[model samples]
Structure formats: structure tokens, C-alpha cells
Target: MDITLKSTLPGHQNPVFCVEKGYYADTFFTAGNDKGVVEWDIEHNAFKRILCAVSSSVYALRLIIGTPILAIALREGKLLFVDVEEQKLIASLQLGIKAIFALAHMSWKNELLAVGEAGTLHVIDLSTYQSIYEKRISTTTIRAIAIDEGLGRIALGDKDGQVYLLDSTDFHVITDLKLHNMPTTSLAFIHNKLLSGGRDAQLVISNPNQLHDNFSFVPHLFTVYGIYPHPEAPIFATVSRDKSLKFWSSDDFALLKNISREKMQDGHHLSVNAGAWSQNGQYFFSVSDDKLVKIWEIKKIDKLVANS
Candidate 1:
């Protein structure tokens, strides 16, 4: 695949914490230590507008699929539901989480899972948009959550460097492993494997139920903040505090593209906190502590057939 910097967008006054593909086709959203969720148009390389404003720093954002509501996770332990179609705040849910770091929608189960600071996990029934269960699974902050509905597993990573695979139905720990010496900062399930990254600058690929089937490597110089897989391709991207975004092959887990800050003129100079691929897989968006949102244009390589 061939990737290049398409544009650099600057607007956020503070470090950008998270980025997520919006409910729409060509749109995406980003937030951080910012006051509002800013929406951007990927097709025209422009800012759409602030979808809504909140009272605290935004740590995470996710879309409630099949609807106009966007879930905004705030720093003060509150979840805000915003109606993007009307550009208004719909409702709020406070679970006493202290802060929220990640959110995942189990659309198949009609549930939403939110895990965050103080090791709190909140399960909300989308049917009612209310808390179904709230529990503290760890003594420290839980930084990552990945739900595999097909496999019936929920992968949780914590600041204590522990990784747990839980039963998606009951949220019970199925497998437990210490994968990092420092905090496990990110986690994602890709192609039947759980890909985890951490503050120890390491990346690990392992099976959810079989703990012996796994391998680890140091892929960054600092914290690996986010792992984002392409919407359709067998490839994924990991961003880090080292100020670079790395593309890896899911087929062999090989490093394919490294967008390093030192070489790319538009690359992030500070910690690249998070990234998300466009819904159509034509472009990629990354945000950083440098307070810039960068759009990267991607092109899949095509091989011509050999003439007989």
C-alpha cells in the first residue's frame, strides 16, 4: 500500500486524545483536552463544525451504530449522548467511573460497554440507554476494551499492565496475562487475534482463550496509544507517544508503513494519541498532542497479471 500526507488540520487548543469514524460516510470526529467534539469532512479536506460542547475534557468517542446519536466520554465520569442529525445533546449517563478511556458498542447484543479510570466498567442497555451493570474489575485504571461478539470475549487492559479476556455474556474473566511491564495502553481484536500495545513500548498478538499462543515485540520507543485496523483491508495502524503511526500487516504481523515524525513534514511531532480509518477505507485520520489533525491518503497496490 502507498500512503501520503494529504492535509494537516489545526484547530484544537490542547492535545488531541481520540479520533473515531463518524456515523456518516465521509465524516469523522476528534476530541481531546478540548471543550467540543469537532467534526471534519474527509472528502473536501475541511472542518464541518463542533458537533457539541461538553463541560470537561473529552477522552473517548464512539458512535451508536444505526442511529444519529454519538457517545461522548468525558473526563469527569459522565457519558453524553449527542444527536448529530440535529446537533444537540440528547442525554447523559454518569456511572461514577471517575473518567472514561474507551467505549465499544455491542450492536448485535443491543449493549454498550464503557471502561475507564478507577477500573470501572459500565454496561448500558441501548434499548433503554441506561446502565445495565456497573462494576470495578481492577484497582487501577482500565485503559483499553475490545469486544468480540462473534467469539463471546471481552478483552480488557489496565494501567497495571494486566490483560484479561472475559466472557462477553457475564463479563467474567476467562484468561488473564501480564503482557507489559508498564501500563497496557491499547487493545484491539483483529483477524482472530488480540493486538495489544502498551506504555512499555511493546506490542503483543495473542489468542483470546489460549494463552500460550502469543508473541510480543517492542514496536515503539514510548507508549502505544492506539491501534486502528483498516475497515476492509487485512492491515492495521498503531499510534504512539513516539510521535509516529505504524501500519502493520494482519496476514503476517509485519510492519508495512512507518509514518515517522522526523521524516514527514506533516507528521505529528508530539505524541500521536489516536487514529481511525475512514468508513470507505480511502483515507486515515490521526490526532496528536501537537494539536493537529492529519489526513493521510491511502492507495492499495495493484498487481498486473502476467501475460502468458
Candidate 2:
């Protein structure tokens, strides 16, 4: 399969940190140093409209399933619940004085999870919109969080390159391991194994079931910011400060392809921070420091057959 750039949409004035697909899949939302959360209709290739503009950089954007509400995380330690359909703010809360870098919904428990420089993992009950749990996981910034419902595990990565594994039910620490010399930049869970990458430019694979067989590799030239699996395919993608997007075989961890201006005619001029896959696994959308959102697709190559 060959990856090709479909379109480059420009509007943000600064680096775009996060990109998330809307409930409809064809629509996606993005925000960053520009401080504006703008939704885009990928099917029509048009801007849906700006959802909200906060006073600080929007570092994370997550959409609540089956609703028009969006969870917006800002660098000023504020979490704004915005009604995207109405373009109005529904509710807001100050998470802390330090910036919030991550926010995600724990669907199984009906909770909204957020963490950042404050070093506390905040869990809010979605039904009550009340803080249900708070735990200090680290003294430094928590850069990434990943949940595995099947394994009942929660993984938190901090700026100190330490990965904290906890029980999803009680939020009790299971194990803590130092994986890199620099900050742990991203985290993802596949088949109950924790996959973590860092500013040290390394990717480490650790399995709770098999504690002694962990492995590591250098996957990028610079910091790896995001690692996400395809919605339906057995493949995953990663974005980096190295200014490229790469695909990998999920089963074997083999490099599939790399997209970059140096390697491909169409690539980001600046660091590519994040990427999201279409719900059907047909396309991808990525945001970068260059202030652009790019749409990409994987094209199948047809080979000619000869009859003897």
C-alpha cells in the first residue's frame, strides 16, 4: 500500500498539537498553539466552523460519543466543555495552574480522564460532571495516558521517562519502570502490552503477562509525539517532531512506510504532532507545526499478470 497526500488545509496560525475525528468520522476537529478549535468536514473538504477559542493553547481535543459535546484541554490548566453544534460553552473548570496535556473518556466507567503538568490524574464522572477521583502520579508533567479495558490497566507516562501502570478499578500502582533517559512522550496499548515512545527517540514494548521479554528500538530521529492504532486495520501510525508520519505492522512491529517531505513529494515542513484515522480505515488526517492539516490515503498497487 502506498500513502498519498490528499489535501492540505491551512488556517491555524501556530503549531497544531492534536487532531481528533468527530463522531461522524468524516468530520474532525483540531486545535493547538493557535488556541482555536476548528472542525473540518473531510468528506466535503470544507471548514465546518470554529468551535471555540480559548485564552491559551489548546493541547488536547476529545469528542464525547453520541453527543455534540467536546472536551477541550488547554495549556492554562482549563478544561472547557463546549457544545460544538451550538458554538457555545456549556461548562468549564480549572484543572490546575499547570497546563493540561491530555484528556480522554473512560467509556467503560463513564468518566472523563485528564492529566498534565499538575501531576494529578483527574477523573470526573460523566453523568454527574463531578470529580470522582484524583491521584498524584508524578511530580513532573504527565505527557500521555492509555487505558486497556480488557486488561483492566491504565498506563501513564511522565516527563521523567517513567511509566506508571495502575489498576483501572482502584487506581493503585501496579508497577513503575524507567524506560528512557528523556521524557516519555506517548503511550498505546495493543494486545495487553504497553507500547511507549519517548523524547529519547526510543520505542519500548512491555507486556504485563511476559515480564522478562521486553524489547526496545529507535523508531524516529526526534521525539515521538503520538502512537495510535487504525480504527479497523491491524496497523498503527506514529507522528513525530522528526517531521514525518510512519506506519507499522501491529503484529510484528515492522516498519511499513514513512511519509516525509524528504522522502515523499508531499510532507510537512515542520514537526508533525498528531494524526487520526477515519472510522472506516480509508483515510488519515494529520496536524503539524506548520499550521496545516493534511489528509492522506493508502492506495493499493495493482500488479500485471502474464500468461505463458
Candidate 3:
């Protein structure tokens, strides 16, 4: 599979922490260490507008399903709900002394979850915009979070290399597994399996009932910074500190492709930080520390299937 560069959007002054595609619109949102959230129009390749002002660096941003409300997490432990259409603040929840690192939405339960630097997880109801559940794990900083909306489960990873699975309805700890020898940097879920990548340069896949010794690990050469599942394919993409992005088959974890900016003539000069697959599954987008965003289109075959 060949990746074709479509366009580059340049304006961010800091490294992008997260990028999320809109549910029903041809738009995407980005948050970063710059303490700002910027929306973009993918069709026109232009910036839409800045959503809200943040007190500290924005680490994560997620748009709730069936609403214009966007949830944002700050390094200062504050979660803000902003009205994207009206460009106004809907609600702000202060997590008191715990710095938030990741945020995700559990659409099945109509709830939002935020993980903090102190390993505290707070679950909030979108309808009432209230904190319904909160708990603290024994780990250090919580670095990443993923929600299995269909199963009504939440998975959280911390800097101390632990991953915990919780029942979304009652916020009870269902299972706990250690994922890495070092801090876990990212977590994702595709199908019935949970995927985690970390500072130890390892990626592991496991089920909820598995013990730490039972999970299988995939070896890599560099610290994994990001892991995202392809929208419609049985494949996943990972970014590493080694300056390359890897595509792996979900079925057997086979290596499909490796992408680096140096291999592409117009590649950015800094490390790749975040990536997301386009809604239609025809394209993929990635950003780097160089403050550049690039879009890659999947090549078409004679049969017209979009695969790499």
C-alpha cells in the first residue's frame, strides 16, 4: 500500500496531543500543549475556529455523540464541556488536585470518562453533565484511556505500567493487568481485544480476563507514542519515537507497512505524535512535533478496494 500526501495544514505552535474526527461533519478537532482547541475542515483544508480557552495545556479532546458538545481535558485537572456550534461553555468540572491526561466518551452509557495524573478516573453523565462516579487506582499518572461503548467497559492505563478494566455502569474495577515494563503511553480497543503501547517499546493485546503474564506482547525498537485502529479495516496504526509509523494487521499482528517522513519528500522534520483514520476509511491523517498535519490517501486498485 502506498500513501499519497494530500495536503499540509500548518499553524499550531506546539505539539498536538490529540486529534479527533467529527461524528457527522466533515470536520476534525485538535488540542495541544498550546492550551487551545482548533477545529478544521478537512474538505477545504482550513481551520474552522478555536473552541475555548484553557487554563493549562490541553491533553485530550473528544466530541460527544449526538451533540455539539466537545469535552476537553487540561493538564491542570479541569474538564470543560464546550458548545461547538454556539462556541460557548456548557460546563466545567474541576477534578481537584489531579492533573487530567486523557478523556474518552462512552456513547453506550452516554457518559464521559477522564483519567488524571494521579491515576484518578472520573465518569460524568452527558445528559446532566454531572460526575456520577470516581475512583483512584494505585498507579502513578494515568496516561491513556479507551472505552468499549458496545460492552459498556472502560480501560485505563497509567504511567506505572498498569491497565485497569472497569464496569462503566457502576465504575467498579473488573480486572487489572500490567501492560509494560515502563509507563504505558497509549491504549486502544478494536473488536473484543484491548491494545496497549508504552515507554518500554512494547505493544500487548489481551482480553479482560487475562492476567499480566497471559497477555501477548509485540516487540518493537522504540517507545510507542500512539496506537489507533483503522476505521473500517482489520488493521491498526502505531507511531513510535523511532520516527516511523507502522501498520499492522489485527488478525495476526503482521506488519503491513512502515511510513516515515524522511521516506516522503515532504515529510515533517520532527517526531510524529498523533494520528487518526478518516471516517470514510479512504484516508489517514497524522501530525508531528514540527507543527505540521499531513493527510494520506489510500491507493485504489482495479477492483476499487481501499486497502494497503
Candidate 4:
């Protein structure tokens, strides 16, 4: 597959911690050490508005589908519910845990899930905006969480190099496997398999039903911060502290492309923290410690295909 740089946007003054794909067309939100949550109008290439600015670093942001509400997780264990359209804070809560590094909207249960430094996971009801449940998955810091809404499964990765698979409905542990020897930084479900990456600099694929069915690769030179699957295609993207983002086929774990200024001139100069893929699979947005958000698209495929 061929890719091209479409746009490089500068907004956040500090490292952008996260970029989330909003429900609205051509809209997404970004936040980080800048302590500000800014929404962007991707189609128009302009800033839409600030959701909220906090005293602490905003580590994660998740948009509630079919609603204007956004859940913001902070570095100091605080959670904020913001009305995105009105650009105002709706409610706030102190999680009393630690820095929250991951957030997921569990629509099926009308709850928001957050995990972080304390090794605790908090489930907040969207309707009541209250913590209904909290559980400790490990003694180590939890760095990533992924939910498979259709299958009712939740995956959690921690600093101890463990991956916990649980049933979202009851939060029952299905399997707790040591997939990495170091901190597990990213988790996702792609093509019916659980994909995990870590500071071990390894990406591992495993089937939930069969422990024997697994695949692993040392794809990067440093910590892997994020891994995002394509909306429709059999591919995914991973960002690392090695200062690069790579595309891979989910089916066979094959590397398709490496994206970086070292490989291509238009890539990020620092470590890429996270990335979000558009709903249509036409474009990708990546944020980095360089304080830049880049938009990438598949460079005209027809001509390349014809020539081949």
C-alpha cells in the first residue's frame, strides 16, 4: 500500500497525548501536556473549539457516540465530562486512583472505563456520571485498555507485562496471560485476535479461545505507545518511541509500510504517542511528542496498481 502526507497541523504546545475520532463528520479532538482539549475541524483544516482546559495534563479523551458528551481523563486521576457542542464542562469527578492513561466508552452498558497508574479500573455510568464499579486488575500500572463491544470483552495491559482478558458484562476474568516481559503499552482486537504491544518492543497476536495460537514480532527499536486497526481493511498502524509509525497486515502480521521522515521526509521528528483512523479508512491522524498532528492518506493507488 502507498501513503502520502496530506497535512501537518500545529496546535497543542506540549506533546499531544491522544487524538480521538469523534462521531461527527470531519471532527476529532486532541489533548495532552498542554492541559487543553481542543477540537478540530479536519475537513476545513481549522480549530473548532476548546472543550476544557485543566490544571493537570489531559491524558485520554473518548467521545460518546450519538451524543455531545466527551470523557476526559487526566494525569492526576480526575475525570471530566464535557458537553462538546457547548464547549463546557458538564461534570467532574476525582477518581482517587492515579494518572489515567486509557479510556473506553462501553456503550452497551452505558459506562466509561478508565485505567491507569494505580493499577485500578473505574467504571462510571454515563447517565448518572457516578462511579458504579472499580476493580484492581494488577499490582502494576495499567497502561492500556481495549473493549470489543460486539463480543462483550475487555482487555487490559499493565506495567508488569501482563494482559488480562475479561467479560465486560460482569468484569469476570477470562484469561490473564503474560504476553510481554515488559510494560504492555497498547491493546486492540483485530480480526478476532487480541493484539498487544509493549516497551519490550514486541507486538504479539493471540487467539482468546486458543492459547496455543499465537504470533509475535519485534517490530520497533523502542517502546510501542499505540496500535490502531483500520476501520474496514485487514491492516493496522503502530506508533513507537523509536520515532516511527508502521502499517501492518492484521491477518499475517506482515509489515506493509514504515512512516517516518527517516523513511520519508514528511514524518514526525519525535516519538509518536498515538494515532486515530477515520471511520471511512481514507485517512489517518497521528500525534507525537513533537507537538504536531499529521494527516496521511493513501497516495493515488490506481496509478501505482496499473504500473505494477
Candidate 5:
């Protein structure tokens, strides 16, 4: 990948598990073992402020676009809705499960879907901020979720190493694929294709239309905790417990760059828990067990060519 470490934002008191887009294009949010979700200004790599404080660790965060509301999933299965603009906890709901692992916002359906240790998916009606539906999709935990709006499909990966494609609106299972030998820890929709990462340290990218026909490779030495696809670039990144962040070609899933502890003196020493690209794809952010968020500035291809 034609990228380099731009700067590191340090303030999270504990391991940061998730990073997400902020209200603006130049801003973003991150949370994890820490007690509050944090907002950062990317322009100066500055920590803006704590968006909201929580009682337990945060596992995932999603900002409802065009609104000040921030959705937080906690380790204890409590989901909090906070209005960042007003800076107050507006609503809190318990999904009645433990360790809510992921949350997918369906803008088209105006719902929030959360999955966790219970293997039951909780559907929250964003309009009411209440649980409207719940269903157990696996005997094991559903650790990852990715909604492909263009395809009208939602991809879910479970602790059983199985990835299921579901009808986004009706929540009916369309197809299931066994992509890993261990728990499928992360999932992403790179355009129309589905990419998955696993505890087996494997990365599999496949055409969702024909799930069985796929490409697989071992991308890390430990569990792949995150898979972040660029909103506009032809590349994606995966962070791992192996304490490394890697960039891959979206076209062929080729290893483009491997930023590891062995190669970079400034890389995360602990497991890189999660990563996200900015809404404009100008920068990439990664959070880790080391209690830090590192930002990578992307240099444009045209700029690189001119410099070359």
C-alpha cells in the first residue's frame, strides 16, 4: 500500500477495539476497553473530546449519519444511544445478551442490528430506540457483521467459522458458507464481494453470488480482528492479534504492504483490534491493545506519480 504512518492519537486508557467515522469528514471516533467513546480531529491528529462515558468496555460504535446520535455496543450487552451534539445519554437499551460484538446500521430500513455472545441478533427500531425483533441465528457467538446496501444483503460471521448471507429487510438466510476452520472474527463488503477474516488467521474473499467459489490465504499469524475497506480506493486492510496491519489489493487480494512490529519501529506492540477508513478515504485509522489509535495518511496516486 502507498501509505505511511501519519500520526498516533494517544489518550484511550485501555485497548481500543473500534474506530468509526465522526460527524464530519475530517473527524472520527474510537472506543474499546476505555470507559468512553472518543472523538478525534484528523486535521491535526488531535483528540477532540470524549463523546460519551460508559459503565463498561465498548466493543463497537456507529454514528447515525446526518444525526448527532452515536450507537455504542458494550461488552455487557448494553447498547447506548448518545447525542453527541447535546452531549447527553439520550437512550440506553439492553439487548438481554452478553458481549454485543457488532452493530450494523441499515439506513434503508432505519434499523440497528446487534449480535453477540448469545448468537441472537437483536433488531432495534431506530425510530423508537427499542428492540423490535430478536432471533438466534447460531449456537455460537456472531462476532462480525457487514451490510451490503447495494446488494440488499447482510453478511454475518459466527464463532462457528460460518458466514451467512441474509436478506437485509426480512432477515432470512439466503446462503451460508464455511470459510474458516475457526471463528470468523471480521467481515467486510468490498464492493459486491464479501471478505472475511478469522481466528484461524485466514483471509477469504468471495463473490457472494457464488459463495463456495472463493480465494483464501493466511494473512496474519493470529486472529484477524478487523477488515477495513476503503470507500473509494482499490485496497483494503486487515489488522491482527499478531500486532500488524496489512494492506491488500482489492482486485486480486494481493499483499501490497505489511506494516508489522518487525518492519516498523512505531507499529502497535499489542494486537491491533480494529481499523477504519475515513468517509472521504483520505486517512486510515487503527486501534490496538496498546491503548493507542494510529492514523495513516494516504498519498494520492497522482501525487505519487508526479513525485516519482
Candidate 6:
């Protein structure tokens, strides 16, 4: 299937680092190396405002569920909370001396986890905005993080191609597995399994508890930049440096369709740096180094059967 470019919203002075959907409105937030977070209104197809600014490049951003607050991570190891509706700075915290790479929020417990370039995890309580627990994993840089509310687990992937599972409540290390030879770039939980992508040009699926076993890798044409699961379907999308978005069936890891920027004729001309699936899962958005954003609608599939 071909991807149609809906529109292009260009305002960032540098490459975008992350894009997140707003919890309470029809808006989306994007953070980039320009040290600012821009709020884009999807319904209007344009940017509404530059929500906030930081001292250094914003490397990570996460929207807390059921709140108007946003967690912004800076390259200088500072995390700030911005109230989106009122456009005010709610709070701010510093993570000592290490640069933060990823951020995740636990909706159930209202806790925020920040991972640093040194593979240190800091768990912060939203109510008091205090650090409850912290752990360091040797000498690896944490690249990605995912929270599993169902199993009370937090997954952390590092630059050395290792994934570590820890108890979300106590921050105890549960298990550690070396999953790839290259840095793990992204992680997503789908269908009772964990999906991971990395610079090794491989996508892997495995059980979160038993990461050392029951693992499978599928080779890709280019470095896998991001992997996101559909909200309500049995499929997910993978973005690569080759400028192609491929949809895969989660059950069997089969490629269902490929969407390339060239096919859309939208002048999409950069390696995909980041991509995200909407909350409703009906549409997906991707941002590239070429300074363009493209949204694609997912097509439903019908089963075909024949009498044997």
C-alpha cells in the first residue's frame, strides 16, 4: 500500500528528537535539538505554539497520562514539567550530572522514570517530585525504556545490546539478557511479548521475563530507528534509515505492507528519525531528518479462506 502525505509542518531549527500525543486534547507535542517543545494542532494542520524552552537540546519528552503535564529531558541532565494547557512551567528537577536519554511514566502509580547516558535509572514520584529509588547498570548508556503495568515490570535497553528487567515497585533487577550486538534503539510491548530494534539492522521479539530464551530476530534492509505497536490491532510498524515504513503482523512477524515516502510524492527526503502511532491507532506519524512529518492511515485487513 502507498502512504499519502497529509501535510508538512515546518518550524524546527534542528532535528526533532521525539513526538508525543496530548492526553486531553487533539494536540501533539514535538521536542528537538532546538531546545524547544512545539505543540501542533492536528485538526488545524499547523503548530499552535512553542510550549517551552530549555537550556540545552531537548533529547527526550513524555506526556503523562490523564494530565496536562509534560516531562521534558534536556541534554544537560535536567527534567522539567510543563503544564500544556496554561503554558506554564509546573516543576523542574535535575538528575545530578548524567545526561538523560529516555523518559517513561507509570500512569497507575503516577511515577516517572528517567534513564541516563550511563545506564542509571531514576524513579521519581509525581506527587512529591522526589527520587524514590535509583540504580546503575555497569557502564552502558541506556537507549530506550518501556513500562509494563500489567506485569509490574520496567524494561531497560542499553548501548551494549543488553536488556534488563526490573521490578517496578522496588526497582530490583529481575533479569538481564544480551539481546543484540549493537545498541538497542527502541522498545515496545505487544501481544505479551517485547519487540526491540537496534543499529544491528534486526528486529527482535521475546518474552520479557525470559529474555535469554524464546527470542527471534528478523533482518531488515536498514537500521531500525523505531518500532511501535498499533493500539488495538495485532500489528505494528517499523521505520528504518532506508526511508521505508513496513507494517508487520505481530503474531507471525510477516510484512504486510511497505510505505515509502517517494511513493507518496510529498517530497519526503530524509532518513526517518522518529515515528509514533496515534492513541486511537488509526493513524501513524513519522518525522525525518529532511524536516517533514507524514501521517498514514492504517487499512483494515479481511481474511481470505478456501475450503480444503
Q: For model 2, how does the per-residue alpha-carbon lDDT over 58-172 read when each residue is reduced to its tens digit? A: 8888887778788998888888888777788888888778899988777888888899998899998877666778999999999899888888788899999998888888888
Q: Rank the candidates by lDDT, best first.
A: 5, 1, 4, 2, 3, 6
Count: clashes, candidate 1: 0
Of models 1 and 3, which has the larger lDDT? 1
Greater-TM-score candidate between 2 and 6 = 2
Each candidate structure's count of clashing pairs: 0, 0, 0, 0, 0, 0
Candidate topping TM-score: 1
Residue-by-residue lDDT tens digits, candidate 3, 205-306: 877444343455654567787888876677788887766777788778888777775566666566777777776766677777777777766665222334
Task: Indicate whether candidate 3 or candidate 4 has the larger TM-score.
Answer: 4
Residues 1-308 of candidate 4: C-alpha lDDT, one tens digit per residue: 78988788887888998998866768888889986888887787778877678879988888887798988899989999988777778999999847999999888788999999999889999999999999988998999999888778899999989999889878978888899999999999887888899999998888854334778889899999998988767778999998899998776788999998789989999999999987567778899999998888866544433443
Expressed as tens digits, the lDDT of each residue in 39-77 for candidate 6 is 877777788888987888777788887888899988888
lDDT of 5 by residue, 1-308 (tens): 46788898889877888999887778899998877889999988899988878889899998887788989999988999998878899889988748999999999888999999999888999999999998889999999999988898888999989999988878888888889999999999986788999999998888876577688889999999999887766788899999999988777777888988899887999999999888777788999999989998787844533433
Looking at model 2, residue 104 earns an lDDT score of 70
Candidate 1 Cα misplacement greater than 4 A, ranges: 301-308
Supply candidate 5's per-residue lDDT for 240. Answer: 97
Error of 4 at 186 (Å): 0.2
Tell how far residue 50 is off in model 2, in angstroms. Answer: 0.4
What would the TM-score be for candidate 1 when compared with the true structure? 0.95
| All candidates: TM-score | 0.95, 0.94, 0.90, 0.94, 0.94, 0.91
Listing every candidate in turn, what is its Cα RMSD in Å to the true structure after a full C-alpha superposition?
2.7, 3.8, 2.6, 2.8, 2.4, 3.4
Better of 2 and 6 by lDDT: 2
Cα distance off (Å), candidate 6, residue 24: 4.1
Cα error, candidate 4, residue 66 (Å): 1.7
Query: What is the Cα-based TM-score of model 2?
Result: 0.94
lDDT of 3 at 285: 76
- Output the number of the lDDT-best candidate: 5
